[model samples]
Target: MTSPPPDAFANPQKLRRGLSRIWHATGYSLQGLRAGWGETAFRQEALAAIVLVPLAVYVGRDWVQIALLAGSVVLVMIVELLNTAIEAAIDRIGPERHELSGRAKDMGSAAVLLALLLAVGIWTAAIVQRFAA
Candidate 1:
């Protein structure tokens, strides 16, 4: 009997040490970011982040506060990227509409929404505490 093909997933472990792995990983991350940028919703969120992240540093009083503010915004971006990835994978499964696919997409969207809500809540609390209280 013929041996099965090597697992594509196993290739990461085969990667050599030093600058090459870092270079390849960085390239893959950039590619993912580019793919995410192609989606309109991701583009809008990224644009918002470009503004909000800088504003976070200014608004926050201390390192902890700044971290909270900036981290929340970053969390939103991370969730958005993950959601986009999930949607893309679902789309790759097939063009036909299926309940599971719809559910998966909807769930991914909900995750993004929840992340946004968390970020908003954190920002609001921090702003009010710093200024109002």
Candidate 2:
């Protein structure tokens, strides 16, 4: 029987090339977000923060509070990106229906939900404090 191609397994050079491709893909993803004007729900939350940022500054809130609010917005985006990755990975593994794939996607969604809750909590506290004062 004939042997398969030697390049079937990745060598160091191939691994390096793969890593480079991954880097470029990450850059593309950023560009996509920018091009889309961050229209995703996660991006909308970021936009909301952008709008509130100036207001927060005008109100002269403490640095800690501002940091918390900004951090929460970032957290939502990060979690969403991770969720997208998880869903993509699952799909790549197998496009067919499977319990594990469903569970993985569901878990990723749950993580995003938790991040959203955190963002809401921060926004509510900051807005209430700014208005109350």
Candidate 3:
């Protein structure tokens, strides 16, 4: 594969090496989770995930099915986090309205909606297969 552009390689954050990089990255990821908890929508999805992940284990008959079920639940939370990130970035840009900012936020919201729908479909199918068969 082609190497990243020189400018990309020049990122100052990339200077960290080895275990220091991994430890710092883990801390940063935790910080992001804390930030995500501050968003109401993300908090709600996280709470739902707490319940649904275990349900997925119960509902699924095999490892593949379990992974698909659990992954779908996590996917909704992932989308919600991304949507929250987009909104936070736009908000940080300033409170003033702009067409592009509005559109970006709208698209992010749409992504979360789609992820939720997909999760619902997957879970519903799994449930039906488990009980309705």
lDDT of each: 0.88, 0.75, 0.90
Write out the backbone clash pairs for model 2: none
Candidate 2: 10-residue stretch with minimal lDDT: 8-17
Q: What would the TM-scores of all predictions be?
A: 0.86, 0.67, 0.90
Q: Give per-residue CA lDDT, model 2, range 1-133, as digits (tens).
A: 6554577475433333477968977887887567445447656766876876665565438888877777777788778777877886898898799998999999999999999898788788778888887
Stretches of candidate 3 off by over 4 Å are 1-11
* Predicted model with the maximum TM-score: 3
The pairs that clash in candidate 1 are none
| Candidate order, lDDT descending | 3, 1, 2
lDDT value, candidate 2, whole model: 0.75
Error of 2 at 67 (Å): 0.7
Clashing pairs in 3: none
Question: Which 10 consecutive positions of candidate 1 have the poorest summed lDDT?
Answer: 8-17
Mark the regions of model 2 whose C-alpha exceeds 4 Å error after superposition.
1-39, 52-60
> Which is better, 1 or 3, measured by lDDT?
3
Can you tell me which runs of candidate 1 are displaced by over 4 Å? 1-13
